[model samples]
Target: MPYSITVNGAVREVDVDPDTPLLWVIRDNLGLTGTKFGCGVAQCGACTVHVDGQPRRSCALPVSRLGNRQVTTIEGADGPEAKAVQAAWAARDVPQCGYCQSGQVMSAIALLREVKKPDDKAIDLAMNGNICRCATYVRIRAAIHDAAKALEA
Candidate 1:
């Protein structure tokens, strides 16, 4: 089946089964490899992407269900929040293995977009499922705070 979906501000076509996970389509069909596959069941946030500006787990989302919704992966993550998050991530040295950083960044950007100045509790609530193998939670929280501050300035 051929499905037409908007990704990264562009309409893209992919030929695959209706049940094919969006992650594979984004990575294999569209050649966008920023989204990672951690837990296929959606337990981990490695496959997090923005589906219509909301963070969604691409690993569990079926391509056919996308309809006309827009998908934003790490490759296409832009704008002020994205820049602030990326800068804060780099300045705080947030990534260790670097595998989960894409999803982490995606989640962080979404959170920052909704919450201008997220406290520790809000950060914890927002980044609940993104698991970093190297256990960089402290730095991740700090980076989110830093990004929030940068956005404030």
Candidate 2:
């Protein structure tokens, strides 16, 4: 099947199986490698992306379901929330292995957009499945708080 989906503010037409995961479409077809492939299963938040402004596991999300909705990858993430999240991640030194940070950032941005000033519990809840092998939980929490504060300013 050929599906036309908007990605990174651009329209992408891809021909693949109906059940093809959006992760492969984004990485292999679109050449957006920022969204890494982690546990293949959705248990890991490695292939996270914003589908219509909501963070979703691209590894499991089928491309066929994305009818005309905007898919924002790490490459296309923009606006204040995205900027603050990125800056806070860098300032807080969130990534150690640098594999899961994109997913972390995407999840963080989504949380910030909704909660604005997410607390520890909220941060933990929002970032639950994003497994960072480097054990950067402390820094990830700190960066979320930092991004919330930055968004406030």
Candidate 3:
């Protein structure tokens, strides 16, 4: 089946099975590989993307289910909050192996979008789904706080 979906401000028509995960279509068909596939299951937030400005697990989201909603991958998250988070991540040296940073950053960006000054508990709740094998939780929390401060400034 051919499904038309708008991604990163571009409309693309991809031919694939209707049940195919949007992650594969974005990475394989559209060549947007920034959104990594870690666990394939939605348990790992490696395939997190913004569907209509909300973070969603692209790995489990079917391409056919996506109607006219816009999809924003890590490549397209360059807004003010995202930039602040990116800068904070760099300053805090958050990523160790850098494999899970994209998903981590995406989740963090979503959290910050909802909660500007999230405490440790809120951060933990919001970021629980994103599993980082490197176990950089301390640095990740610090970076989130730093990003919040940067946004306040």
Most accurate candidate by lDDT: 1
Q: Which regions of candidate 3 deviate over 4 angstroms? A: none
User: Lowest-scoring 10 consecutive residues by lDDT in candidate 3?
Assistant: 95-104
Output the better candidate (1/2) by TM-score.
1
Off by over 4 Å in 2: none
Q: For residues 25-138, write the lDDT of model 1, one tens digit per residue.
A: 999999999999998999899999999999999999999999999999999999999999999999998898999999999999999999999999999999999999999999
Write out the backbone clash pairs for model 1: none
Each candidate's lDDT (Cα)?
Answer: 0.96, 0.93, 0.92
Clashing pairs in 3: none
Model 2, residue 53: what's the lDDT?
A: 90
* Clash pairs (backbone) in predicted model 2: none
> What would the per-residue lDDT of candidate 2 be over residues 25-119, giving only the tens digit for each residue?
99999899999899988988989999999999999989998888999999998999999999999999888989999999999989998998898
Estimated TM-score per prediction? 0.99, 0.98, 0.97
lDDT of candidate model 2 versus the reference? 0.93
lDDT for position 112 in model 1: 97
